[model samples]
Target: MSTPSYHPAAVALQAVLALANETEREVADRLGLNLTDYRALSTLSQSGPMTVGNLAVKLGATAATTTAIVSRLQSRGYAERLRGEGDRRHVHVSATAAASRDIMNLMRPLMDATNRHLESLPAAQQDAVAGFLHTARHLMQNHLNTLSTKDTA
Candidate 1:
């Protein structure tokens, strides 16, 4: 009988996520942001305007939950929901200038510190590690697809 081949990619992805999430949670606590709000703000910060459905997908959350978060951000003047330029039925969310500045300020130190940690690794190692992580993310998408399919079943 042949034994199953061990998959290091999955292990590495999990380990990296665990470490990153732990560090991010600590930073988030200090920033006084809940994880969900942090993730939503991050999504908008990175991807620019997004529909609630898209934001939910980015945050791994439900549409209803995303709506609540969006509402809160709007009340805080951190984000605004606008009628889609092309389609009024579809709403798009955009971060206000203040929100953008806030997110950048909060993230700069974390990004800089993380970069410093990565700088200790050899250039070749950095590329190799990044390659592995890229592959891991692609592979993880398949896992997500499976879950979506299962939900339909």
Candidate 2:
């Protein structure tokens, strides 16, 4: 077989994703959380309160699994469950203030480091990087939507 050529952009993108995943895993470890719990915490922190079904969608977990995760978080005092006003059966999960603070403390250093690195780049390069990330995010979201639709079908 002939040797295959690799695109620089593809390699760089893969490296970036791998680095991000590794960093997240390290942060999760430092927080004494598994990857799934960490991801659920992240979603709650970013999205405020959401129903279990919504959180399940966000976490790509089933309702039963998300409930167990929420239970664990509640036991740890990291999350709270709120009952809906009109419908007592409807429940929403939110990250507690302590959880938010802890997550911020854990992530601030990484955010600052990334910001410093971005600052070292030229303004034009920084803008290009931002644009590329925005585009990549949208493309990935579209692909995820397609996959979800296919799964449902």
- Which of the numbered candidates is closest to the native, going by highest TM-score? 2
**TM-score of decoy 2:** 0.85
- Deviation of model 2 at 67, angstroms: 0.8
TM per model?
Answer: 0.71, 0.85
lDDT of residue 19 for candidate 1? 89
Reference-based TM-score, model 1: 0.71
Worst 10 residues of 2 by lDDT: 2-11
> What would you estimate as the lDDT of candidate 2?
0.92
Predicted candidate 1 versus true structure: per-residue lDDT over 1-153, tens digit per residue: 997766886667678889889866765575467877877876787889989999998887899999999998788787899897687898899888888887778678878997998899999989998897788788778989999889989
User: Number of backbone collisions per candidate, in order?
Assistant: 0, 0
Cα deviation of 24, candidate 2, in Å:
1.8
Model 2 residue 151 CA deviation in Å: 5.4
What are the Cα lDDT values of the candidates? 0.82, 0.92
